[model samples]
Target chain A: MKYSGWNILKQALTGKKEWAPVWHKPEPKSHYETIVIGGGGHGLATAYYLTTEYGMKNIAVLEKSHLGSGNVGRNTTIIRSNYLLPGNEPFYELSMKLWENLEQTLNYNAMVSQRGVVNLFHSDAQRDSFVRRGNAMCIAGADAVLLDERGIRNLCPFLDYENSRFPIKGGLLQPRGGTVRHDAVAWGYARGSDSLGVDIIENCEVTGFIIKEGRCVGVETARGNISANKIAVCVAGSSGRLMGKAGIRLPIESHVLQAFVSEGLKPILPNVITFGAGHFYISQSDKGGLVFGGDIDGYNTYAQRGNLPIVEDVCAAGVAIMPMIGRSRLLRMWGGLVDMSMDGSPFIDKTRIEGLYFNGGWCYGGFKATPASGFCYAHLLAKDEPHPVAAEFRLDRFKRGHMIDEKGAGAQPNLH
Target chain B: MIINHPLLGPRDASEFIYLGDASLIDRPDWNSENAAQQFYEYLYLRDNPAGTIRELWFHEYGDRSWLVVTRNTLTHEIVNVELARDIDREEKHSR
Candidate 1:
């Protein structure tokens, strides 16, 4: 049990460039019961379900690079279920529930911290909206508490309370919302699925779909064509192209999100704090480094490099909120590709193509939803039916006018 | 709405696009949830204390980036928006 989810998280959260390839050779068996593309959280989780839940052992997870090299390996790791839409709400809630029991679910340590999250509100209008969202989460069985000025002051005492910019009117607090080790979530699933005998192929990129008679039979990878009964596409950052290859268009936009860490400091704050008016969120890592992240890149590109203007803006907000951190210097900053959808929520559903399934379009909440996404996706992959939580994320939503838009923003990458 | 270059400090009033009534200025606690709340109170409340100079102008409605100048009764005309950088600037006010 020591290899429990949290322990593995201890290693992954440090962001060490370690971790070597474990199992599986490059030999494609020409056929598998299920073939999952993209070895990130969603793909690995889908593979895990195909094996453990359905007892369907003929499965394989194909990654272009080594495992966890995608967004799964590069995220801010904030886990929360404060959604406003029905399609996204239940799934995120389920993901939050999964995070609660991740140690038992994966039998690995993921450093799941229930430090609580506070989404602040600036204006009365904002307050009302925040309250509505909080109430919905409360009804959905999440521990959400609505806070006012006094309430916010009690939680975060070191803020610049006098003549400030975005006044600390109040925040919506979900005690269950916290963070975890992102990389470990990937390795834990990879290990869990590996132990279950799923073939996880790394450094093997999918070249094209083996579409036979309008049905996907397998994928033609760089090594060669590997046939399979069912195929899953889970390439997050670069998923749009892969989906396009299958003759289907997904409402996914690829954008870059940047994250930074301040030099390690003693843990002064216990909960994760975010600025409502300005786009900024800060959390202290176990390494004592202050982890910070903000808004998506205004443009679309597969490039991993981030712009510096946003860095300056977010840093200014940080200083305005917590002047005490004026002495804190940003040690390093990195960017990751985001598969932002029309709505800010994620989508994981089967496509119109026969023998083909998809598990992509997780905007920013991929880390916390790893296990639950895997569990439900596993269920979806095994039974050929959408999990109860993932039923509404169909690709036809846009055409049908049934979009699950939590932010009321369309799938434009710049808006998100 | 138009806001001055030098961030208008709490209650320290200048020419601002007519949004609403005079807003009050309240002190912010070191630890508060939305940090932007302190300045926003200025929109609804004004702390126009009499016979004193407050060296502050606010860009509450940050719609456009413009180079505007501001002056106070107690002090001479100052603050050139030509170089309205986003950096935090400090000016000592003699009340």
Candidate 2:
């Protein structure tokens, strides 16, 4: 059912009784052309694009749990394409463009707010580094503005500008970057894909892959065995475990990254502000809650939870940059398992196993790359070739010593 | 989480830097024919189990000791902690 103003009005006139489900819940079939594992934003978007863009309608997405139960819903909801690396800038810029037209494309109110993102810099060295990053963003055709201390003060007056230890020097701003309603993207993509005849199977945990000879032809799930011409795995942090069942050890580590939201208050934050000396990044939600997150828990684990020390560390970072955050009581905090790659980037390429495609290693930065990752994964699945923008995201890049170290954090997974 | 160190009584887990699986300490021989492949697997691949796991943790804050902490990943419970240098010495002697 295509939603419109007139449809809503008609439904309202009829006592709002004829409202349909957002997406159809279909029973799993024995066979399909392609099977997408994980029904998060990336999986749903991949399914949506496979049907819409590639005309491959005989697709099914297998989610282990209810939709949006993963990192898609447990993120800070910020989006930006202000990257510095050549292997990353163009790809994120494409994602930024896709984000610009996402609402119109899906005909869904995703609330794609373009309130801008400002990365605060504390020291001269950090400012110089941001200057380079801003120039790189401009080179990649993305908007970037280098803000001085005065400009930052004007933008966010509440920020701690004069902390003696970590004084705020300036900031690098991306004017077109902002936040989106995280779950809405998943819902819209699921609805659009369902409308295009893609089966979205929920609560069906994949136990193992069906390997015939040397190719992965299907999957063994809790429901039953389902065959497919192509099996695409995109289960974020669970990538290592899922791929391990096929005797394929992934170059990914699962880390629990926690996100927090404070009690609703009067809207104060105008733009997304990231702490220069620390890992804290926060933005006020439309509901007036301050949504924020810091670094991932520095350990490799599959559990969707975190420890108290990291909580203390994150709150400390928050208080360090914005002293007012201490007054806002934290209403809720949740953790999401993130697939931290060796080089702090993501992978969107085919694996060695024939008919078995892989799309993960997103670390904690997967939410912002959802659309582009899905589009590129769909393109790869349909055409058996990586998309031009995603050509650098090869799974074998580590073997070839071509790692896309965006943060230049070397080979450390947690640091990334 | 608190790791009861062998020498330094007990220390908060935050004071230690988490490396990863204890299998990382068993570094493959560099002179092997498939050293590149072995290094790739050693550096990237990990057995991230849902149950008990032995991981490497360095107490950078307290006694500067690299420890092998056997903990349950599901429950985040520290079951055992030992000096990694002792493990290295034992392995070398056994070899």
Model 2: per-residue Cα lDDT over A1-416, one tens digit each: 56789989998899988788988899999999999999999999999989888989689999999987898989889999989999999999999999999999998999999999999999999999999999999999999999999999999999887799999999999999999999999999998888889999999999999998989999999999999999999899899889989888777888899999999989999999999898999999999999999999979777799989888889999999899889889999999999988899999988888999999999988989999999999999999999998999998888889999987888989888
- Which digits, one per residue and each the tens of the lDDT, describe model 1 over residues A30-146? 788888898998788777766776788878899998889988878888899888777777878988887888767777778899999988787899999998898888777777999
Question: Candidate 2: interface RMSD in Å?
Answer: 1.3
Give the candidate number with the greatest DockQ. 2
- Which lDDT values do the candidates have, in the order given? 0.71, 0.91
| Candidate 2 collision pairs | none
Candidate 1, chain A: TM-score against the reference: 0.92
Q: In candidate 1, how many Å is residue A354 off?
A: 1.0
lDDT of 2 by residue, B38-81 (tens): 99989877777767889999988877889999998777888999
TM-score of each: 0.76, 0.98
